[model samples]
Target chain A: MSSPEVLVHLHQKAVLLLQDDANKIEKLIEVQMENLATRKCPLYEEVLDTQMYGFSREVDFAVRAGLIEESAGKAIISKLERNLAQLYEALDQKSQLL
Target chain B: MSSPEVLVHLHQKAVLLLQDDANKIEKLIEVQMENLATRKCPLYEEVLDTQMYGFSREVDFAVRAGLIEESAGKAIISKLERNLAQLYEALDQKSQLL
Candidate 1:
């Protein structure tokens, strides 16, 4: 591969890896949201928080390493944050209903 | 730059960035070890743990992204873990003295 090709491939790979990590966290949020009323794992939130933190670190490193654009990294993280917010909102509504 | 040159440059840059992060954590450990008796920040350990987690995440991402060899990533993390263990041991001994 040429220089530009190599860089592009690396960038795509970095973004793909980050997206995979984000999807795992998204899955976690979905599971917790689905089981919000059934399985009361108190550590679910903690686990999610830790996962998000670790994933964010990965994103941050990618940005710094020039593997992906800063804007791309920010977009991925923002999307996850929005989903997480929605989950928390749903949890709040459920608590209010109870 | 040529393809090989580009790869070499990226690999070196990734290692440098990770080393910089590891050094920051080392500095944190050093500061805490120095203040092991006086400052008594109950949250120091928590902060260090969080930093270590974040740093490790960066290393893991770099390895997955193909920016660094897995062994290089492991070495960086292992060195930090050793220093961290020493700090904890010293903290333990100090408490024992108390």
Candidate 2:
């Protein structure tokens, strides 16, 4: 492959990998949302926060390494953050009802 | 640059980037150790753990992205883990002496 081709391939692979990670976090939020009635474990929030932090680090690394564009990385993270915020909102409402 | 050269350059760049991250964590541990005489903030451990978790994720992503070898990634993390463990041990010893 030529130089541009190599970069293109790496960029695509980087984006795919990041998307896959974002999906995993999405699944986590979904699972927690589904199980909201199962004795709200305090640890779940910590787990999600840690996962998000690690993911942000991964995204930052990809951007710094020039594997993915900065805007693309931020977009992926923003989507997940929105989902996370929704999850937190639901959790808050649940706690208030209790 | 040829295909092999491109790969080589990326691999080197990846290593350097990871090493730089590792050094930042190392510095965190060093500062905590040096400040052992002062009142130990419980939050430091949490911060270090979170940083380690994030760094490990970055290393994992680099390996998955083909920027670095699995063994190389593991080695970088292992070194940091050892340093972290030592810091914890020293903290424990200091607390016991108090």
Candidate 3:
């Protein structure tokens, strides 16, 4: 038995979008983290404030649209937050060392 | 020797947003990937189309607003596309095998 094809496709696409964004963010974090570690200036903040919230809002939209479960979206956000906190802490420490 | 605080802040935020989304997407891909690998049902789609496009739209807004450079936004999208392509291919392969 297959799930509704449209819904299934939506589910697939939803995760794909999130996963794609996540990968993009990971690389940015890596580059910025390197910048922080090396005492180079960090970049991407000006855009990030708007961009990150925008993406999260999209996820929220998905939940609202019933394309995906709220729980899953929340889980993704929780994980993302945890990762960001760690990255922030690492950058903070590195910056302090300089 | 710091840049103008406002621009600097914006730049920092921009990258943070992209990076955070990237992190969130990475986990979604990972979970879905595992699902595919195990020949289990895969999930997350309808929502992603809107969410991903929404986030990208925001990135476009950032560029238009002059919060971040166009090149950086393009670069993020390009990288994200590459990752998504890779995941899609992998899933396709696994599904065919099953």
> Which of candidates 1 and 3 is the stronger one according to lDDT?
1
User: What fraction of the genuine interface contacts, i.e. the true contacts, does candidate 3 reproduce?
Assistant: 0.07
Highest-scoring model, TM-score? 1
Chain B TM, per prediction: 0.96, 0.97, 0.80
Q: Which is superior by TM-score, 1 or 2?
A: 1
Candidate 3 or 2, higher DockQ: 2
What would the per-residue lDDT of candidate 3 be over residues B1-98, giving only the tens digit for each residue?
A: 23355446545666677667766766666666677646544346434444456667656645644556899989877776677677788877876887
Q: Provide the lowest-lDDT 10-residue window in model 3 chain A.
A: A1-10
RMSD of 1: 1.1
DockQ of 2: 0.80
| TM-score, one value per model | 0.96, 0.93, 0.46
| DockQ for each numbered candidate | 0.89, 0.80, 0.04
Task: Give one digit per residue, the lDDT tens place, for model 3 in A27-96.
Answer: 6666666676465444565344445666677566556445458898887777766666777888778768
Q: Rank the candidates by lDDT, best first.
A: 2, 1, 3
iRMS, all models: 0.7, 1.0, 18.8
| Candidate 1 Cα misplacement greater than 4 A, ranges | none
Worst 10 residues of 2 chain B by lDDT: B2-11
Let me know the TM-score candidate 1 reaches against the reference structure: 0.96
lDDT of model 2 at position A67: 92
Q: Cα deviation in Å at residue B23, candidate 3?
A: 31
Q: Write one digit per residue (lDDT tens) for candidate 2, span B2-98.
A: 8778888888988999999999999999999899899889999989998899999999999999999999999999999999999899989999999
